[model samples]
Structures are given as C-alpha cells and as structure tokens.
Target chain A: MSSRIDTKTKILDAAEKLFAERGFSETSLRLITSKAEVNLASVNYHFGSKRELIRAVLARYLDLFMPAASNAIAELQQQHPHASLTDIFSALVSPLLTLNSIRAGGTRTFLQLLGRGYIESQGHLRWFITSHYGEHLQSFVTAVQASVPTIPRADIFWRLHFTLGTVVFTMASADALIDIAAADFDEKNNIETVIRKVIPYIASGVAVSA
Target chain B: MSSRIDTKTKILDAAEKLFAERGFSETSLRLITSKAEVNLASVNYHFGSKRELIRAVLARYLDLFMPAASNAIAELQQQHPHASLTDIFSALVSPLLTLNSIRAGGTRTFLQLLGRGYIESQGHLRWFITSHYGEHLQSFVTAVQASVPTIPRADIFWRLHFTLGTVVFTMASADALIDIAAADFDEKNNIETVIRKVIPYIASGVAVSA
Candidate 1:
C-alpha cells in the first residue's frame, strides 16, 4: 500500500480496536493517533471528526459483513428455493460467527462494537447504518417473509427486531456473561456455545405466533 | 423535602438523565453537577465517585422494578398454581410495562440505561447488577422452569439470557427503530407496542427446546 493508504488503514485498524475494547465515547482521537503512530493532521485529513471516524469504522465492517450476508442469502435462494426460517437466520448469523476466524481483530470486540451500533444510538451511527444498509436489511426481511409465508410482515419485523436485540445484546455482553455464568451458574460458555444456543432461540422466536 | 435529601435527589435525577442520554463514559461529574444545579462537593458527599453513582442509579431502578417483578411472580404462584409459560412471562414483564405509568422518569430512557447496563460493561455495573439481583433473577428462572418443565436449567438460563438480550436490545433501540420503521417501512412503534410485541416473543423463546 502507498504511504497515504497505509496511514489511513493504520488509523482505521487502531480506531476499530480501541472502539471495540474501550468503547466509542471512551476512545479518543489522540489515543487512536498514538496507537496508529499517525499525526493529528493525518487523522483530521482522513476523518474530519470523531463522529465521522466512528462512521468510517462501522462502514469498514459493513463493507465486509453485508456482502457476505447478501451472498449468503443469494446462495440460499439458489440452493434451497424453499428455505426455512432457520436456514435464513443461519445465513444471517453464520458470517458473523466467522469474525472469530480473523486473527488481526478481536471477534467478540468487533461484535460488541456492531451490537452497540444497533442497540445504542450514541451518534450518527444509526442513521449511517439505516441509509447505507436499508436495502440489504429489507432483502433479509424479504427472505424471512418467504420462509414464513403465513406470518404478517409486521409480526416478522417485530420478531426480527427482537431477534436483532438478542444477537446484539448477547454478542455485546458475551465476555462478561461467560464469566458470570461460570461464577454464578457454574456453567462454562464460550462464544460458539452462546451462538449455538442463541440461533434456535431466535428461530423459535421468529416462528412463534403472536 | 429537606435540603440534604433534595440535594441528593437532584444529583441522582441529573446523573440518571445524563447517563441515559450521553452514556456513562461520555457523561462526566462536572456535567452532572451542573445539570443538577449542585456542586462538586455535593456529588463527592453523595455518591463518592461516578462508578458508585452509576451503581446507585441502577440500584434505584432495581428497588422499584424488582419488587414489582417478584410480586408479579408471587401473584402468579397464588392465582394460578399452574401458570403457563406465557403466564410466567406476563408476570415477569407486566411489572416493567407499568414502569411507563409512573411519570417521574421516561420509561424508554430508564430502559435504555438498564439495557446499557447489561450490554455495555461500564465500570462495575455488571457485577453490581448480578450480585444484587442474582437471587431475584434465579427466582424468575425457577418460575420459568416451572412453566417449561421439560427444559433443562442450563438451557433455561441461556434462553433467559437471550430473552434478556431481546428485551434490553429492543427497549434501548426503541426510539431509533420507531423512526426507522416509520421512515423505511411506514409503520409506527411505541414503548407500549414494543413491550406488547416483546412478551410473546420472549415467552416462546424461553419455552423453546434446545
């Protein structure tokens, strides 16, 4: 990569890590620049403000994540024309589970960041998300509608909203809840276990009638 | 109210509002005191530190919210010796729905704060909540167990955790989603509608088999 691009990538990587670990509000441009080993001028040049920087961070993830999800849906459509609700949900979530496979970034941390974007409307993140990914979200909604033909679109949306809640909340709180489960419930839970557990719960939730 | 008590209430109210709106990390003691019309010394005199102050705010909600939940369970136990899964769910959720009836606080704001408690592990809030509310939580767990006798305790807890994520995530993002639904889907969603929509979804989730 050229120096200019390398500088931008470094800043993005540093921001993503810090935002995930320390949280968006807690992570500062100074911290980000110092970690990235870039100057304030570069940070300003690349992303004008912390708000825009945060949007850029999410946009990076969305760029990677949404394509994988959209492809998953497309593949499901071709392979299983009569896909079940579970299959559609699996397609929606399985790519996220692969975030653990990437070595450079922390999967749970990235998941936490993504979950926070959806759950907490802290900045321009929500608007950035809806406008950018609205069509992709609606496509998933359409996929879900086809799977559960009888369910009302409103019911599907409401349940899907509930499903998003479960995903975001569970992913965001994964590490803490893992420890708490061990300490309080004497049960050990890893990320895979939690996802394995959550999928059916969400599928069942979506399938259940009002 | 006496001056001392008035000062304390003012501090608590301001802290809760700021924390909900700006988040725990983003909201500072200086901002809080200024908003409360109190002084720095008074914040120190009242809550000791921001961590403790956050815990105290949550404890306030638990004081009001838990008893209502516990009482709902008790009433279920008395009223229907054999309450169904939906009944147990209704018992657990109906009290929280009534939190809207009280005018002192915005239900969505309080719910956002509570949801953030579980989603984001800001300071010592997670441990504070688990330790304080563990027994009451276990009681609700047991109530769900009775309703869904076939499900294992571990599965119940995991599902219950998922259920919580759905509740917290949905409630925290209620306002943003309401607008998005209005804008993108041409639908209207409110706090009450969200609650009514959420309960059945949770009940069905908790009852689902692994």
Candidate 2:
C-alpha cells in the first residue's frame, strides 16, 4: 500500500484498539500518535480532528458491516418471507462473524468501540450512525416490526434500543464475562458463543408482549 | 450532619454526579474536590483512595437497594410460590424507585454509576459487588432459578448478565432514548416507565426456552 494509506491505516488501527480498550474521551491523541508511530500532524492532516478520527475508525467497520448486515437481512426475508424474529436476528450472525476476517478480533473490537461511543459520546456517535446508516437500520427495524406485528410501533422503538444495550454492553464486557463463566461454570466461550448466547435473550425480549 | 459527616457526604455527592456523567477514569480527584468544595485531604481522610471513593459512591446505593430488592423477592415468593420470572423481576421496581426518596434523580444516577462502574472499571467493580454482596445476589439468583426451573444454572448465569447489560445500558442512556421516543412517537416517559417496560422484556428473555 502507499505510504499515505499506510499512515491512515496505522492510525485507525491504534485508535480503534485504544478506543475499544480504554474509551473515546479517555484515549488521547498523543497516546494514539505514539502507538501509531505517526506525528500529530499526520492525524490532523488525514482526519482533520479527533472527532473525525473517531468517526473514521468506526466507519471502517460500519461501512463493511452495515451493508453486509442489510444484505443478510434481505436474503433471509427472500428465503423465508415469514421469518421469525429469532431468524431475522440470527441472519446477521454470519455478517458479524465475517468481521473477524477483516482484522483479528474485529467483531469484539468493533462492538466495544460502539459501546464506548454510545456510553461516552453522549449522543454524537448515535446521531452519526443513525444519519449515515438510517436506511440499513430502518430496513432491519422494519423486518423486526413485521415479525412481531402485535407489538406497537412505539414499543418496538424502545425494545430495539433495549436490544442495542444488551448486545453492546455484553460485547464490551465479553472478555470479563467469559473469564467468570470459565472459572465459575467451567464453560468455555468466544465471540461467536457470546453472540449466539445473546441472540435468544434479546429476540425473546423484543418479541415479548407488552 | 456533623462537619466531618458533611464533608464526606459532600465529596460523595459531587463524586457520584461526575462519575456518572463523565466516567470513572475520566473524572479526577481534583475535579471532584473542586466540585464538592472540599479539600483533597478530606477526600483521602474519608475514602483513603479513588478506588474506595468509587466503591463508596456505588455502595451507598447498593447498601440500600440490595437488601430491599432481596426482601421484595422474598415477599413475592412468599405470596406466590410459583410467581413467574416477570413477577420476580418486576418486584425490583419498588426498591429501585425508593432510591428517588434518598436523593434527587437517585435512581438514574445509581444505575448510571453502575453502568460506568462495570464498563469503566473493568472487573474491579464487578469483583467488589459479587464479593461484598454475594448473599443478596445468590438469593435473587435462586429466586430466578426457582421461577424458571427448566433453564440450566449455567444458562441462567449468562442470561442474568445479558439482562444486566440491557438494563445498565438502557438506564445509562435513558435520557437520550426518552427524548427520541417523545420526538418520534409523542410518548412521554419517566424512569419508572422505562423500568416497567424493561421488566417484561427481560423476564420473558430469562424464562424463554433455550
């Protein structure tokens, strides 16, 4: 790859790792630069600001994950026109797993970064995601709504955010939970296991009657 | 309150607000002292360390909520030995709301501090809670297990954590979600409304078949 591309990639890699492990506001530009082995000027020149850099870091994963997820949902609908909520949620599993091939621990890292963004950014990141990926999100929400037709629209809105919390917070703390489970219950788990484990819980939660 | 007690309360009041708003790591002793209008020496004298201070902030609420919650669960089981999982989870609402009587916005602030504690402090705070309050936790878990005897113990473990993520993340961003709901659906909500809505979702989730 070209030097400029290499520089940008390096910064993103460092930023994503720090942002996921630490947090958005807690991770400083200087720390990122030091880790990326690039000067402050490179980050400034490439991303313009810390906020943009954070967005770029997330956009890298969302750009790949969002359309892929939407396509997966579309395929599921075509295959089973009357798919259940669980089926619809399960359809995204493959796309989420595909993130692992893009980078080592990509799935967990992306999710942790997302959890940090929502919890720390105070709605800026939420707005960015909704505005940028509203179509994809809307498609997913519509699929969910159709599956649980009895649930009112406003209720679906709340349940979806509840679902977001379940997935994001779980993934952000996946490592810790895994450790506890292993020590306490002697059950081994990975990202895939954690994802599969949460699907039923959230699907059931979303579909439950008011 | 005596002068010494006043200083301790002052530090805790300021610390909890900042920790809930910004985060645990992001908020420093200096900032907390400044906000509390107390000297750093008083903070050290009372709490001994920042970690202890964070624990104290959470413990203040947990000290109240845990026993009350456990008592609520016991009462529900006493009244209806076969109470559903929804009943068990719903029983928490009263004890949680009692927090509001303790302080302004206590319910939201306590839950947010918890989310921050779990997400920001890594496993330290988790260890603190489980170790310090294991009896209360076990009683509640046993109540849940009795309600859903079909689900394995290990699965219950995972589902409970998933429920934690859902409630923690939801309450942490409760303001944002409430705003979105009001804007999009013209529905007004308060902390209690959100809590009631979540009980059904989580109760169904935990009781659903694996």
Candidate 3:
C-alpha cells in the first residue's frame, strides 16, 4: 500500500511540474512517465489515464486550496460581517501563500495549472472544478455579493468573471511577467508579491459599481 | 496581383478562424491550407512560416486597431483635455468594435487571437506587439498615467497588465460565458455588450487608489 501510494505521488509530482511548465495538451504521458522514472504501466495503474492524472494533479492543489480559502472567508465573515471587498480578497492571500509550504512553488504551480486547465482543456476542467467545488466557489461568490448588495447579481456575475480572468491570465503568465518586471524596472518579485499586487486590482474591480 | 492578394486573404481568413477557435499551436499549416483550399506553398509564399503567419494574422487587426485606438485617445485628450480613466478606456470601445466592420465576428476573433497569441507563443507575440506598436501602446499608457497621476508608475504597469489579462481572458472565453449567461441569467450578450460590460470593471481597477 505504501509503495502504491509512493508511485502515485511520484507520477503526480512529475506530471504537475511538466503540466505547469509546458501545458496539458503539449505535455505527453510518455514524457511524464520518463520524468517520473516510472514505466507506462505505472501511470496507467496509478491514474487510469492522462486526463485523470491531470485532474489528480490539479485536485491536489484544489483539495488543499478550496477548503482553506473557504475557511478563511468564513472566518473573515464571522469576525467582520461588514468586510470590504479588499478585505475579502485579502483573506484569500494567506490561504494561497500557504500553498508554497506544500511544495517549493506550489502556489505558482497550482495557479498556472489552473490557468492552463481552463485555457487548454476546453470545458472539462471548468466542469470538474465547479462540480467538485461548487459549494466552495459559491461561498466565495456569495461573500463578494454580500459585500456589494447594490450591484445586481448578474452584473456581479460578470464582474466576478472579469476578476477571474485577471487572476487566471496573470497567474498563467506570472513567470515571464516577473522576469520582465525585474529586467525593466529592477524590481525583484516572487509569486507572493505578484499575488499581493493583483488583490487590490481585482478587489476594486469586483466591487466597482456597474 | 489581385489573385495573389485574394489567395493571401483566403489563407489569413482560414488561419485566423482556426487559430481563434482552436489555438496557435493546435492549428497547423496543413490544416489551414486544407481549410483555405490552398496549397502549403501558398502559405509559405505569403507568410514565410507559421510563426510569421500568426504574427501576420494578429498584425492585420493591430494595424487597424493600434492607430484607431491611439487616434481615439488623442481625440479624447484634445476634446476633454482631462478625460477620466473611464472615458479614456471607453474611447477604445469604438475602435475595438470597428473590427467587426472589417469581418463578421472580427472583434471577438481578433481579441481571441490576441489572447491565444499571448498565452501560446510565450513571449514572441508580446515582443511583436510591443516592437511593432510600441508608440501606440505608450500613448495609451501615458494617457492612463495622466488620468491616474497619484498612482505609482509601477502600480499602473501592474494594473494595466491586470486589465490586459481581464480583457484577454474574458474574450478568449467570451463565447462560452455568453452561452452560460444566456442560459442561466437570461442575459443575451454579444461581443459588443461583453466589451461594454468589461470597460467599467477595468477602468475602475486601473484608476483605483493603491
């Protein structure tokens, strides 16, 4: 049982790294097996297929992130029922940053995986996330809606999506943007700094009156 | 001469459609040739390579958009002398929508292509746009800076990128979102309506106090 779990983990680690660095469709299962140093049979045994492996890789992060983010928001709402949009968004930061503790660059990796998943896999990943974590996502959306009651739910819907686009696209290209920012502005930044920078922008955008 | 131009336009039309619908890396010269009903030699003759073809496809829209957007901003500055950030952002709406006049579904296609280009090509498309249309971009950035004099340049840089991500990601997935909105919220949104919806969100985000 331990050995089986070890093989599963080995496949996931190699898969996630490749998926994040390259992309889903571009990263083949053969390369993943080679990187994991496990044969084809091992991947098949562990994850059933490449698609399942992709889901598993993402689930690893989402499993950790969703509950933590939900808990953080829940805690914030309990403490400060009238929390501002920025405050609500800021609450997610700690949960997001804690991802780095799970792996060397877990936060960045998870986000990139997310961006890639959404962009590459058509609606499969979206369906997977929503079906699995609908309640958690709903909680976050509900908190934003509660903060801005005046905005219609539909407009809130659109704006929240806009906010998602901001974070998703930003995280997808975070590494390149970081390198460029460092070269052009002499500003050395990591994933945390970039995440912090985006919160205000998204918070403000989500709360803006339509 | 006319036949050559026709063949080139034929290739571009087919290439853009496939590239936007699928993606840059997913669409191949052979597929584009098959869709265009032209030979591979024609694409090679016209664009030199797939990378160049992608650039050409984007450049077609940018050539029209960059100047029109700049001129719109220039006109806004000339007329108002102190246009607000919303007004500055709103100025580009006409230019963006004007893309439709050039082709059916052109606005969405151009935006989708831009999103795909940025996401797929790593830094190549970014480099192409900046190098080719640097002045136009700088002017828009300068106008934005003028509106938000209080915000730091670096903050503006970050926010503008946030804004780009918002627009890019939103448009990339606009078709799906529109479908969902129609089904769930009963909101019928075309590309124009979506663009208008995002303008306020981005304008507010761009000008928000740091």
Candidate 4:
C-alpha cells in the first residue's frame, strides 16, 4: 500500500508541474488532484487548500535547496577560511547548480516554480521568505559580506540582490535562451563551469579598486 | 481638442501602468480604457487589440532603448577602435542604464512593463519579442560577441543571457530593494551609480582571462 507521505508527495509533484507550466493564478485545484492521480478529497486532506499546497510545492524545493546551500557554504568556510572573494562567491553559487543537476524529474519544474515566485509580482514568495527563509537570507548575506570585505554593506546588499536575479533568470530561461541562440551553444552542467563563469564577473563588480 | 495621437499616447500610458502592476493576463482592456480616461472605442480604434496595445507600450521603451544602445556602441567603436572587452561591455550596457534613468513618468512605467515582459513566464513577451525585436536581439548579440573574444562563443552567450536577466531584475525590483535597504543606503538618483555598480560586474563576468 502507498504511504500517506507518498500521496502527499505525489500531490506536490503534480502541483509543481502544473504551477510551473500554467502559473499559480491559472492553475486549479482540480487539475492538481487529477494529475496526482488522487481523489479530490485527498488534496483537501493533505494540504487543506490550493494556496497551502502551492506553499508545500515551494517548500519542497526550498527544503532541498536551502540546506544544501548552507552546508556547501559551511564546508567551504571550514576548508578555506582564507579563501578569496571569488572562492567564496563560487561556494555560494555552486551548490544551487549541483542541486539542480542531480535532482530527478521534478527538479526543473521546481526551478521554474521558484523562478515564478521570484518574478511573479503577486508577493506570495516574499511572504514565504520573510516567514521561513529570513535566517537563510541573513546567513547568505553575512557570508557574502565576510568574503568580500572591500564592498560596503549597502553595495553588498545591492550586488546580492542583483546576483539572485541573475541566477534565477539564468536557470528559468535556459531553454528559451538556447532556442534564441539557435542551439549553437551548450552550457556544461557542472558547478566549476558556473563558478568559472559567474564568480569572476560578480567578484570584479564587487572588488574595491587598488 | 486632443489630437488622435494624444489619445493613442494616453492609451499606451494606461496600458503600460496596468500591465506593469497586474501583468498581462490579469489586466483587462476595460481597466486600461478606464485608467486612460478614454472611451472603449479609443482602445480598439487606436491599437486594434489589447495585445497590440501592450506591444505599442513596449515599443515606445524599446524604440528609445535600441537607438541609444546602438549609437553608444557605434561611438565607442569609432573612438577607441582598440577598446578592451570591458570598454565595449560598458558601451553596450551604459546606454540602457542612461535611457532607463533619464526617462520620467510614462517611460518609467514603460520600463516596468518591459521588465515584466522579460521576466514573466507567461510567454506573452516571447511572442512580442519574436515579432518585434528579433533583429535587434541579433544585433545586440553580435555586439556582445565582438566585445568579448576570449570567452568561448557559447560562454559569452550564456553570460550575456545572465546579464540581461540581472539587468531586467534590477530595474524591476529596485523599489523593493530600496525599501528593504532603506535604513543604511542613500538612494541616489544618479544613473552613473547604476552603471558603475552593474557594468564592472557584468564586464568582469565576460572578461577574457589574461
């Protein structure tokens, strides 16, 4: 027999796909349940409502993402206490690339969902961040500040804001970009490639002139 | 006696604001006409359809943006001839920042509209871009390729993709960021501050290793 948690996950998986493709406003609860292959009552039983289910779908991605990111940064700090700003930035960004690369079928869907949250003006994800990920954000910000001491706090904050934008857009728009470029280019799916590409750009931006 | 062009402009302004705040799907033609203080017939008469009106609004911003960007790159090429990658990158980005900064009122609204087009996943903007800006995108991509020779063409394409993402998000989310960082940061109206902060970061990202 399927476990209760399995049913819940199935609902989340289906909802994530629907949300990624159709968006939050357009997607319906009925569609989510049907896609999950569960009865209508199961969704109500598991998530209570569509809004909560949407949160669950997002939380699933964040659950996988936040800890991986935190641990990656922690590991980097432990190993390279005196790492350069480029190293620290790489540490901060690499885990995300790793996570997306390794995850199974729904990883891309979750990324699309996350991208929607960031880009969507509905303010749903902002509320989620304030309530749940505030500490994670602070920790990330602190790591960035510690890594790049030359940048003023305000500038660090602004640059971080911009960095998040870059990351989200790149992940979400990869397919479209590939299409736009006529498939002439293929990005390697490795953390080193991302770091090699993103770190120097951002580091140069933040580094104080001699 | 308001000229027909005045009514056209009024419709564009209203459509831009409504589209920026609510998005293309959520916004309605009725709301746009109401906001523009024009009759419903004005919208259909002027733009043929709501989608076309949205395109018109975007065209105003891009029309200003494309020329300035082109002129900036042209002037830089003429002056430096042997300009470094960073110089060329600055020429490509600075014009957009300058155009984004000097414009007031409706232009700013139109910018927000352009940002929504770039970031939103509904594919509304994709259709618009393919139809309207296909040639301009090729031109910009060609300019970026010329500027950064050391980076592999594939890498350059991906970096430029991320750069556009970052730029669009910066413009779209500036208000939220400014609000969050309000206590410590001085809100500068100067465009140079934006250019200085963003260009180096993007340039370094695209810079060829020595």
TM-score of each: 0.88, 0.92, 0.93, 0.83
**Worst-scoring 10-residue span by lDDT in model 1 chain B:** B117-126
DockQ values per model: 0.62, 0.71, 0.69, 0.49
TM-score, model 3 to reference? 0.93
lDDT of each residue in A36-67, candidate 4, tens digit only: 77898988898888777878888877877787
Which has the better TM-score: candidate 2, or candidate 4?
A: 2
Clashes of 1: 0
Model 3 sits at an interface RMSD, in angstroms, of: 1.2
Instruction: List model 1 lDDT by residue over A37-152, tens digit each.
Output: 88977888988887778778778767777878888998999999999877887786677766656644445666778786654545366567768998887778888899899998
Q: iRMS of every model, one decimal?
A: 2.0, 1.3, 1.2, 2.9
Please provide, for model 3 over B1-210, each residue's C-alpha lDDT reduced to its tens digit, 9 standing for 90 to 100. 334558899999899999988887778899999888889999989889998999999999999999999999999999998899999999999999999999998899999899777777766888889999999999999999999899988888889999999998888888889999999899999989998999889988888876
Say what the interface RMSD of candidate 4 is.
Answer: 2.9
lDDT digits (tens) for residues A1-210 of candidate 2: 435558889999889999888777678999998988889788999999998999899999999999999999999999999999999999999998899999999988888888767666667899999999999999999999989999999999999999998998888788888998999999999989998988899999999877
The best-first sequence of candidates by TM-score reads: 3, 2, 1, 4
Question: lDDT at A44 for candidate 3?
Answer: 85
Predicted structure 2: clash tally:
0
Cα shift from native, residue A132, model 2 (Å): 1.4
C-alpha root-mean-square deviation, candidate 1: 3.1
Which residue pairs of candidate 1 clash?
Answer: none
Evaluation by DockQ, superior candidate among 1 and 2: 2
